[model samples]
Target: MADPHIKSKMDWLDYVTVIAYRLGFTLAAPAILLLPWEVETGIPAQQLTFLAAMLCASSLHIYMKNFRLILQAATWGGLICAIFGFPLFGLGGAFVTLGGLCFKEYFCFRVPGLRAQPILLAALWLALVLNATLTAPMVVQGLAALSALLFLVTAVAKWRMPLHFDIGDKTKYEV
Candidate 1:
């Protein structure tokens, strides 16, 4: 088994940027934290959930040592945020949550060549500008959900699975 981190080719600055981006996306995922800042129900549990989510996001971002995983989490977080927020904050929340999608697509993946970066950045800016539209915001929840689902499916497919099992050795389990 080889170390996958070496294949990422991301340096310290990339890691730092990714961590900050992930933190921002995760923080924006839950609407309660973004607006009003009030506990409508399950105050204790909500507090715990919020803490756990932030803690887990940080832990995963550091421990996994993989940028893609953080991006996947960001996509899912975006989906949850967009869906929950669309009902409450409408267009503004959707636009904000779309940042998660932008993080996952633009920041996480490499452009494969140096010539493409400027173009990509321009496209990213265009994306942000277009996100302000009411039409784009209306589809944020659905798009976020789709992006998250695709990321999950790709993750599962790429994961290594165990080949051998002990199910055939029933005799050894006899008590």
Candidate 2:
């Protein structure tokens, strides 16, 4: 049986979001790894292998959409860790979350819908990415926290959502 909630149409907007999401993640994943590496190792010349692996993993979401949700979650988690952890714990903190993300996304992404909708995730990704380089840290932290909250709320709701969650549709829970 197929899941009703899963839709993979070829809408133009989907193309835009998918491209942006994939490209952004591809670029971001390497930085997520390399930042701490450079911080500790002072920029190794042979880091391309790690970067290539990250790129491959990022692109895997396209063919294997089931685990994409988990991947998305990890992606956000990485952003959170890198943005906040980098400043707080330095290299170790950054690698901790980044490594956890890669491990989970690579091994456990098929666990279920533990991720928010792709569209919402894309917006959050944009928020984290754009704000990550700002001069002010507080603003980025605030946005990252909000995005994580939003993702969690939507994800939980998605899992526990009433069957008839369509727009204004009423369900037994209302009665």
Q: Write the per-residue lDDT of candidate 2 for residues 1-175, one digit (tens) a residue.
A: 1132544344464344434423433443334333323435666411332332233334333333454444444544444544564433222222332233333432333323323333333333344345446435454344334434433333343344322221121121121
- lDDT (CA) per prediction: 0.34, 0.35
State model 2's lDDT. 0.35
**Clashing residue pairs for model 1:** none
Clashes of 2: 0
Model 1 misplacement above 4 A: 5-56, 61-133, 136-138, 158-175
State TM-scores per candidate.
0.25, 0.27
Clashes of each: 0, 0
True-structure Cα RMSD, model 2: 14.8
TM-score of 2: 0.27
